[model samples]
Target: MTEIPMGPELLSPGQSCLATVEQLLDFDFDIPAFQRPYDWSDKQVSELIDDLSDAQRKEVHLFLGLVVVCTQSNGRFAIVDGQQRLTTLMLAIGALGGTGKILRPKGGGVSSLWISPRHADIGFAKALVSTSSETEQTLSQRRLKQAFSKLSDQKALNLATLLGAQLIVYVAPSLAGATGLFERINLRGKDVSQFDLVKNKLIEWAAVEKDSIVRGEIEDFITARYDTLYRRLDPSSKEEPFDSDKLLRVHWILFTQKQFKSSDKVLTEVDSAIDETYSSKKSIARWIESYLDSLVRVAETWVAVERPYEATPPSWAPQLKHALLDFARLGRDGELQPLMVAAIIRWQADATDLVRFCEITSFRSALAKKNSNHGRSYKWRVARQLYQGTWSDALKQPISLAADAVHQLFWANTPYWSQGEAREFGEDLTLEQVGAEVFPDNALDSTRFYKDYRHLIHYFFWKYGVYLQHSKEWADFTRIDISPFQDSVWFGNEERFKGWDIEHIYPQTPADRDTREGRAHLKVMTQWVDHLGNLTVLPVPDNRGMQNLPFIEKLAWLREQKKVPFNELLATPDYRGNLLNKPHWGINNCKRRITEIRTAAAKLWGFDAVRELGVGPYDNRLESYQEDIEEEGGDVPDNSAETVAA
Candidate 1:
């Protein structure tokens, strides 16, 4: 009989079949030398045996997964997809000796069933088939032996069942056919990710151009860089690893503000999007070149999150590292990632201010959308504009971005405070405090300032710390000098207060009283519970201890017991002198204290510099605050006289 041609034609339809143990051993399986080394751990080995045993008990035909083999010109079968399974099966049979012999070609020189590539694992695989002893067995060999270790009681039946198990054996006639089949499986198979599909689509497009060189280059680049990119992402999740597709989509959105919901859309629409601005091959090539560059850089930025800044950072390093770390941790969920990436890339040399600017912008956006997540469409529009415009423009007109983006953010709903009531009462405040020129109309409604709790707390502490250090009031309240409370406290290193939280100055709960007086105390607690005036940042552990303490006892603890800077600030006469005389901690004192704190914030946040700095004529950005007048049936409270000592 004439033999079939040694090419893809040999893999014609209906050429596939199942093989028994005896037939499979006679077939001369050759593990391709180019394949990756055995990486299946012990768990996989055990699972295969357990599954096979269960199939046998149920009396069902066990269909192991697919195995693709190429018929070589020399008539040997080259194992493709099921190398792990096939290799494990041989080891299992070797462990169970009575069934049949695993053979090598007959000069009897290489008597093993498997031919492994020359590597550390090759010797290990050889030892598994050649010996029955467990002594000095490699990890893989040990796992293989363990799978069949208990089956020594019924070696013949178990080995027969596993070897004869049916698998869909795909026989490709030639090497090229096998490769094409493998590539298709990896690209469109069940485990395929959007990244894999998108990559395949890109190469397919290149292939359409009949540019084998370009196609080959692209494939090579993907094969080489795929693992490196995945290693950069969070490893805990197995469902979706580092989403390269999302990364590319973000870059695309930055440039076009267009959303691609699936891998198909990315490939189908990306070229048209490029064509809108550039129709020539040269322009398309340049665009792809830049896109690839951004991908590489963004990957580096993502990985940089796991590490700390170098000991000696550049002038701008602190803010950049802080922003990168924050994004690495919290900022990933937001729409501002592209902007964050842009800042990192642009200001890398002196990225301090730019990173800070991005952090502020991102946090501000987060605060703006506190009730809901920022939508991709919103971020898309902003990112597109930022990309089309210059980075300098973004830095120069932060307020414009703030105002425009905020207006766009809550375009559908009326503005109001998110959760908290205004601590500083104001309706007609001009933004001139930061200076009139800096803002459009140079007026920011200070009433909305307290709504962004985190930004406010950070700004207050940093500014207050700097001011205290300069005025020789770091420890002492007045000209009566005292030793510095703590030398150079800075939020620059957050680990210094890793366990700290924003502590309420007035305890959220009043002491429990059972009598009529106790009931009255409880009422006061309820009235002032979450009041803005009552809060300050302190160590979480210290705050826990202070909770449930009586008002006066808390005061004494702050003054005499706690070394916490903010707690000490509250204990100072300038801050609590008015409250000191009050017989009880009531709603009145909380309101008045809130007013004093607001005044301090105004100074720290440049309320006085507004006019000189051309800062704002911006209104408070809270939906709750916007309805304050209608909700209360009165104008927002007037704390005009509640100014602090500036």
Candidate 2:
């Protein structure tokens, strides 16, 4: 390849106009394989023409002379440079012809000197000639025809008119020696970063399937629900559609580094692995989709209830990147599934305040030192603190404290002891009250309490199940229902026999059946059935046909339907036991069962079953339990209480 000095030349209207369609047609200007695809829309093309016209009216020398490099090909000139400009000129020539001006030979023998119709540029040039008439046929036709006539009649025209009139100075180099020159020219004054190029190239390749539908499906699936994993760092100035670079990095961490194989590895490799994967887009889309699906499933357990939005701020790009990596690692290690299942359990039991639970847990995890084993322990401690204290104060603690609490709860089983117990345990801690000092009577206050306290309730539930035996005295006195049987059915055995299927006193199919009367009836029946005042475990077969039947008729139907003598069946241990042992006609049965289970649960959590814990009837009561500890000279709860004493 050779470099020759081409002076600053202008495309003057009346000058020799040496740049012919022949030279342009034969040139082979190189575009790199990694460059972004042609993305100019029609409007952008129109803008370019307007700019050129404005420059021409101002008489500013906006149009520059074409640079042509000649490549030897069997004695004919093949342009090894400036194809875009050459091709565009052919488009302009074709546009001129569309105005009905007959293009004739320009300077005598010059027409014969132009390249023949068989040239590659001829096809593109012809397409342009057919379409340029749409611009302005009346005023510019004469000048356009003159321009067109300057090229040979034997030359072929382009199909589409190239809109932008920017001059491209071509550099023709020998086929054997142009790679380095091409690379250098392409890189000149270009701001396309290596990382951006790699990412763009990968997305382009992925978009190239023969079936557009398949390509679109892949793109849609990849981009749908992974803002956490691949969100743009700064959307204000972005030119690309999405954060493919960040997504690529996530893919690398998950698939390349195998960071999802273990929690420790996830903890260790997540950051560096993401960094390494940031640039290349070649395998990114597929990799990202797979990685994100796995990550979400794992995070379902590890994240607290409110975390989907709160754990990583939407606009905080760096943290979001790290968070996704962490998710990938957690998934690989098989540690996140159980945690997600636990979160699901909490969500199902009482969806009242899961947001606070998620937020507090996230705060606990983020605040801990990188790779700290104590992080899980610290998180539980933070949750316990939030439960026992005031809401406003809990929100004020550093986010790190909350993160540490989450780490402790999940990984270490750290106990959150009462203030007094915390002092005895002698662990470093932060304690504060939570909630509004002057409680409001509105629903917001109630919601806040539920939101703030649900995490602790979930923790308790996970540790002790639904059993609350330690509170037997309080439960029995209050007539609480806490039976293990989720549903009940009623059957009878008097003069007229009938039966009743209690169903899920809560009516699992609330949406399936709809009628005001039906709903009202269900509501009343469920209230009666689910209450501690009414519930009975009867034979499943006898209860099958008992739809809304009365007591005496139901009894007769039950005897007939079940094919058993009423007195003999009633005399059985199960039937006699219910009638004689608990005299309130099975009302006491439900109350007794609930009281017993609640008492057991209370004892399991180390509270006295008989005492009131000084809590109000409607209050969370757990909060009152916290207050009781404070009155008894405790400092506040911490992680040490998490473990059961040997």
RMSD of each: 12.9, 22.6
lDDT of 1 by residue, 390-482 (tens): 211222444234333433333322222211111122334344533322221111223233343444454445444445545443346523124
User: Worst ten-residue run, lDDT, model 1?
Assistant: 637-646
Q: What TM-score should be assigned to candidate 1?
A: 0.53
255-282, model 2: which lDDT tens digit per residue?
A: 3322122123332343343334455423
**Model 2: number of backbone collisions:** 89
Weakest lDDT window of 10 consecutive positions for candidate 2: 487-496
Alpha-carbon error at 205 in model 1, in Å? 2.8
TM-score of each: 0.53, 0.26
lDDT of 2: 0.31
